[model samples]
Target: MAIPRPGGGATQVLDRSARTPGRRETESALALAERMPRLILESRRVSSTLAHGIHGRRRAGPGESFWQFRPFVAGEAAARIDWRRSARDDRLYVREREWEATHNIWFWIDRSASMGFSSHLAQGPKVERALVLGFALADALVEGGERTGLLGLTRATASRRIVETMAQALVADDKGQDDDAPPPATPGRFDEAVLISDFLSPPEAVKASVDRLAGRGTRGHLVMIVDPVEETFPFSGQAVLHDLESKLSLNVGDAGAWGEAYRVRIAAHRDRLAEIARTQGWTLTIHRTDRPASEAALRLLTLVAAARGTG
Candidate 1:
């Protein structure tokens, strides 16, 4: 699953770092999730305020809006029994309600070596950012009364008991790392599939996985967390580049001469990603390692809101 680089080779890895016990990483992620309700509420309020002049109908709620009709089940609430429909069909049926413009948001993060890059001196690694964002998004979705879960390139779990399992997997030693871990198996009719990755994998592989999810009725949203160094090619003079995943090394001399070419290649890769996302009608956001999690969270929420509008 190597991505073809502009040079006569391919990019097998991006971030390379030893597995270290992340200090307060779990606590930080939990805290961020805890703050998600307030953040989402504020975002909604801000959006409403900003669009005050626009005339639009109020959105329907889960209780008020009728989604569909289902066969009446034993012990079901009598209030849910649709008498009118029963009179017409002469069959017992319950009225199915719809929730308020909400959808189940499943956060899938990539915890591969490429996600361990960090440019900010004081900031956590890209993997940490992915974890925090996933946690926060899941928390927000849950607060909205939408079912939420998390999945990673190396781990996937749905139970609240395993909510932090993905993060733990990231910090675990990869002495016997399994590269064949399958993509997260999603249930039928997923509302949204949010992927946080550097996308170091091949474009075809990534696209195929996304298409599979979309085929299952999951709307895809890709959040690409890239290191600033990777984006800018800031290395100077002669340098030895290492492949984080494969442990391969390349020596590059005269960084100045290669800087422009590297930047062009990176830009092309990004453009290709953007084009793919656009064609799939998926929200694609690029986050830098230097940006604050709060800023990234707001941007992610904006994407979610935009996707909701399209829905």
Candidate 2:
């Protein structure tokens, strides 16, 4: 797309030197490899710490319907022993209860160019926060016995090794791309979606994507990642802003003067986004990079719990 230069001079052409097929795939994989270790360690540390505060789903009740049986160990209560099942084996067995149902929650982490935005005022890039938060959520969800998967990358599963699963998906060429929009296909009915991104795309595109998922009967929770610099507009005097995706630059004179107008526009955009999500019966949340990631993770988990009727 051609972007008009600031002050309505001449239109500027974007640099597409690396737009060839597999170019991004290769670069992204290498970058992920270099950063995977740090990401994993940080996510594990955060998730472990959060575990002490967040509560898991309640266990099945004593009178709950039986699902299976396991051999009873020493110190077991006699009243809990399954006599019928024990008769089949020499060892005594205990009845195990099943959950009411299983719900699959899929996570979509945006790897778009804009997600790499970082400023002196922020802790890290938007993508870093998304990965860490996504990992932590997967860690908690799997611990709670919920099926979790990376949307468009793998099938949903209730595996304790979710961190590894996500790492593999992140490095996979076919699964991890900075696509501008999600794949056209929709998720299954009753499935839940967790979309982590900056949501900097055009309003219509964002609306269409959410509408597609909602039409497919998938309830969703959106986590919109924003850098502190983007939200606060801390520039002064003259400044240059660049669009990461289109590679277009806009020069501003007295950028400090433009802060209010910029903030107003962003606020309106967010309000519109929230309205769209509400219309589709989904939830939208904003997370700033400068804040603690645990906060975002907890808020997201609460939303998911409420949606599943477990809260």
Candidate 3:
């Protein structure tokens, strides 16, 4: 939703035609290409805050490290049987190697019209925070010997210059990042994902988008980016609010009267989002633009680790 300027103290009053021009969602990736260096620096800075580095997943699959020994099953390859371990027990056993999605961490950041929103109480636009957090997590994942990429947009890579690689991929795509939801991307079964977005879409639409990610058994995390003004409706009196997505303007008479109802509705919306995440066996995190990006990054690292049974 469009933000109205504070008028007469805590109250806000706006003309029906008032429009606060913002960085449009249709902004091209070419512009972002120029900001790559700065954004990269910000991503690196946020990622460096965590002292504990990620390394491997706790699952069993193709890997160099030993994971566990399980009882050998019939029809299994005899070469897989660990003879020495089997001698200690009545049943034959096989050593399983640790499987890591070291090269399968995927990211998707929403760049819709609603995400371009920035209120006076925030550090920058919601889109900016999403980009920063996405890159920051990718940088950290790369540092941990993992590959990261934009879901349905770029291939996963463990490149040291994560921001540059992702930026170049976006530049080539050229299409406007107008989707409020993640693309219909399927991650590897053992893959982990982080979706950065404002997630203001209706719960049904968001659920459909999320299903695309979870369909392939991808362990997903939803990071909901919000503005402080949106979290706390600090406005009162007559005002006009515009819909960033629909671009429709509405006259909000006595904005003060709607404050409680607005908060309740938003709370219900979040509950629905959380429930959808739970049903899909995913996690949800809320990040405010007013806070440090590193906070969300750290939480996500923990979530990914826990999902992989490392934490």
C-alpha RMSD values across all candidates: 8.8, 7.0, 9.6
Candidate 2 lDDT over residue span 222-281, tens digit each: 898887766767667765554555555666677788777777777887888899899999
TM-score of 1: 0.65
TM-score on alpha carbons, each prediction? 0.65, 0.78, 0.79
Candidate 3: where is the Cα deviation over 4 Å? 1-31, 53-103
Candidate 3 per-residue lDDT, tens place, 15-87, comes to: 5554542324324322566766777788878888864755355344455477788777553447768999999
Residue 56, model 1: lDDT of 26
- What tens digits encode model 1's per-residue C-alpha lDDT throughout 1-311? 12224322233222235232221332343333444444444434433333322222236643358678777655334665789888887688766555422345666666565454454432555666666666655544433334455543332222332334444444453421223122657644637788887776666666777777887777878888776666766656765555545546556677677777878877777787777687777878887767665566667666766665666
Predicted structure 2, TM vs. truth: 0.78
lDDT, candidate 3, residue 1? 38
For each candidate, what is the lDDT?
A: 0.55, 0.71, 0.71
Report RMSD for candidate 2. 7.0
Name the weakest run of 10 consecutive residues (lDDT summed) in model 2.
1-10
